[model samples]
Target: MISLTMEKRYEIGLDSYDRLFPNQDTMPKGGFGNLIALPLQKKARSNGNSEFVDGNFNSYEDQWFYLSNLKKVTIEKVEEILSIVEEREKEELNQ
Candidate 1:
């Protein structure tokens, strides 16, 4: 058997959803439209910040990206994971 690979280009930024909840971060949390909006500040995480959720998602709009080829793989992975979480939430709600 043979398999083919596909690439997807997505624009990540601050996304607004119908629902809102606690972000549980040092800074205020808002709707997350897309992740990987910008490069992160070279800093560490504490009680009030995220180790991975650096920079602003709005800065990364209109750029094409793939899951496999990214400078910051952590950000992409986090985005993918969050999307999965959201998908599960919706599925659970529907069910």
Candidate 2:
């Protein structure tokens, strides 16, 4: 399995919902608006062939390119973003 770390940054604003639920809900429960990064590993499979093949080589490159498209984020950065969102939510709730 290929393991990779991700880093994310975010800017959040307070709104009506934030006012309803502040520190009680520091995070979005679930929705497309939530950002998520998942680590995955892919195994190369051959078509009934024990020997290495050209197709296998190509598959590795394809996987690399696909993963490269995803943004790399650090754990600290994610925490920072989450904190910002939570703070905004708290402020909204106070107002």
Candidate 3:
């Protein structure tokens, strides 16, 4: 998984991946020219758009839509939220 700040997630979620992590095989010969470069994971397309999900949609992992507008990337609670969502899903399915 990519270890990116929450702000990055929002930007990417809004089809801004190309804006941040430009489509390049490797770092520019010299240096990125004021581009918002990021180390993207192999799963992420070199140049692709993100799936637009609604903020209230909780089924999607990473919860990008739900937390996209956050002022700060509160990564500290990612696992906690995931765990809680998982537990809720399991309980609902078992009922």
lDDT of each: 0.42, 0.45, 0.50
Q: Between which residue pairs do clashes occur in model 1?
A: 13-34, 14-33, 15-32, 15-33, 26-48, 37-57
TM-score of each: 0.25, 0.30, 0.29
| lDDT for model 3 | 0.50
Query: Which 10 residues in a row give candidate 1 its minimum summed lDDT?
Result: 1-10
Q: Model 1, stretches more than 4 Å misplaced?
A: 1-73
Q: Which residues of candidate 2, in runs, are more than 4 Å off?
A: 1-67
Worst 10-residue lDDT window, candidate 2? 1-10
**Model 3 CA deviation exceeding 4 Å by range:** 1-20, 24-70
Residue 47 in model 1: shift from native, Å? 23
Cα displacement (Å) at residue 18, model 1:
33
Pick by lDDT: 2 or 3, better one: 3
Superposition TM-score, candidate 2 onto the true structure:
0.30
What is the descending TM-score order? 2, 3, 1
Judging by TM-score against the true structure, name the best candidate. 2
Best of the candidates, lDDT? 3
Compute the lDDT for candidate 1: 0.42
lDDT string, candidate 2, 70-90, tens digits: 688999999999999999999
